[model samples]
Target: MISNNIKIKTQDLNVYYGEKQALFNVNLDIHSKEVTALIGPSGCGKSTFIRCINRMNDVIDICKIDGSIKIDDKEIIDNNVDVVRLRESIGMVFQKPNPFPKSIYDNISYGPSIHGLADNKSDMDKIVENSLKKAALWEEVKDRLDEPGTGLSGGQQQRLCIARAISVNPEVILMDEPCSALDPIATAKIEELIDELKKSYTIVIVTHSMSQAVRVSQRTGFFHLGKIIEVDTTEKIFKNPGNQMTQDYITGRFG
Candidate 1:
């Protein structure tokens, strides 16, 4: 069992897509309420490692993973595990904003409704309000709650997705390049929101942008060729990386 201060810990993790291995002997620790960023070139297994946290790779039939992944000291990859509940506890936001084809109100309310989080209409309303407020979108969308979520602009839609993810009251939020699809202004907004969200939720993000990783993460892990080259404070990772590979990648010497 992990100590209370640690929110997540992975032990010697390995992932395979069919017979081809993508990640090898990956070990990591995530502290509560801190933001951890995974950075690397494409195909370096950064995203794959994050997906393993919540078992999201299960969505792909050929993907197979081996390791002990514990969240708050509970092993989540056990056989007969409740994947639905696991995912509910560990929410996710993707590279692209993917809100339901429903009203803004419905998008926020959907998760709580499905999870029986609210007892009645009034309770449901509160859930929606609180979630939207947490995502920094409530005030803007309050008057237009009935508006279709798709009607929102790109940044607003991404925030809506964040709101929807939080509606489940997750303890950990995994974000995969959440700002890659947005404009500079929208990306800045999301970065600000991420800084705020870290006050409550443990956030793990996979990012291709080194500056984005440096701007938002407390600890950054540099991965290459299915291995984590180094994990340290973001300041050290960028300014004084211990590994030659990490220095090379961050300095634009090579991926």
Candidate 2:
């Protein structure tokens, strides 16, 4: 069942990169303050779907998006929509930890500085500290704020990227295979952080790890051939999916 507390709504969201349609007539209602995980084999349009939420596909000259993506009923596809503000409202963390070649403190403060969320050093400092604390990295890196972000361990770097995402106080955070490059221990920390983060921010994650999806998300969507074949509570999707294709994919058939 779709929740009444829908934070993001996508209707007939179709994307075409040049001549290839990457997504097909997709409709999804993402709930507020919840983690929704997208799972599928590669090339299933999972990343493309989330990128559409923030209009990231606009960068590609031939990327054509036809449909509606709304946050609180405000259509994001409108030509007049300020993409910078939109992106600030909906932050993204990519597959690998891609930290800027700046100090740890600078990395956390970059978004707030760009969006004018902080006006003074004190406010920026608080924002930086709180964001790191939220990502659970403050304790480890608090004294090393001057160190370059790129120098951190892989897991720490990914957490740093996450802190940067939340630094802007985004309404929603989109993570694309965020833990793919981390070790089991590092992945565990990121997973724990994701669970805690959903209490304050809506989150959407695209991961190939079915176990990760099961562990981190309340609702799970199974995508296949550029479409979502099934979506339901994680338990049901894993153990009792309604679609055979979904069952096949989850059971390690043809995914």
Candidate 3:
């Protein structure tokens, strides 16, 4: 059943790269102001599914997508869509921390500046501070805004990237293996941040860690070989999955 709170919806969604198919009729509904986690083994098309949300797949020369993707009930697969503006409303954080080679201030302010989100220097400064604070890195990096973003430690750099994503005031945030490279403590911090961020933004995360998915998400979707085998509330999916494959994968029997 499709809920009235659905923030993003995909129906009969299919994706391809040249002659190879990456996704197969993926249908998922992400609720507003909630965290939805996608979990699967390697090469299961989990990342491909989220990439389709913001049309990031459009960059690949051979990529072709069909079917329907809607945000706020508006179709986005059409060529007439404003991609730049579409991207502005949907933020993405990648697997690894890939901050620009610029200073922390520039990193956060760049999106707002290009999008004309700030009117003056003071406004930009405020956006930078607020974004960093939201990402829980303001207290740590506030004193060093002029320093290069890449200079921060791994966890701090990841937080900075999160801040950069939120700086543009996106309504939806997509994270693909956001904590894959971080240590345990760093992963916990990111998890905490995700919890807080979901209060204001719709978050979709692709994760390989079952524990992480249970901890951070309200809804969980299990993908296998380019198809979604099951999706349910996180508690139900973890404690008692409806599919045998889901049960096996979560139990370490098979991936």
lDDT of 1 by residue, 37-144 (tens): 999889999889888888889999999889888998999878788999998988999999999999999999899998999999999999999999999998999999
Worst 10 residues of 1 by lDDT: 1-10
Task: Give one digit per residue, the lDDT tens place, for model 3 in 123-189.
Answer: 9999999999999999999899999999999999999999999999999999999999999999999
lDDT of 2 by residue, 1-255 (tens): 234599998999899999999999888989999999999888999999999999999998999999999998899999999999999999899999999999999999888998999989999999999999999999999999999999999999999999999999999999999999999999999999998999999999999998899899989988887887888888899979999998998888973
Provide TM-scores for the models: 0.97, 0.98, 0.98
Given candidate 3, what's the lDDT at residue 192?
Answer: 100
Ranking by lDDT: 3, 2, 1
lDDT-wise, the better of 2 and 3 is 3
* lDDT of model 3 at position 251: 94
Position 28, candidate 2: lDDT: 91
RMSD (CA, Å), candidate 1 to true, equals 2.2
Clashes of 2: 0
TM-score of 1: 0.97
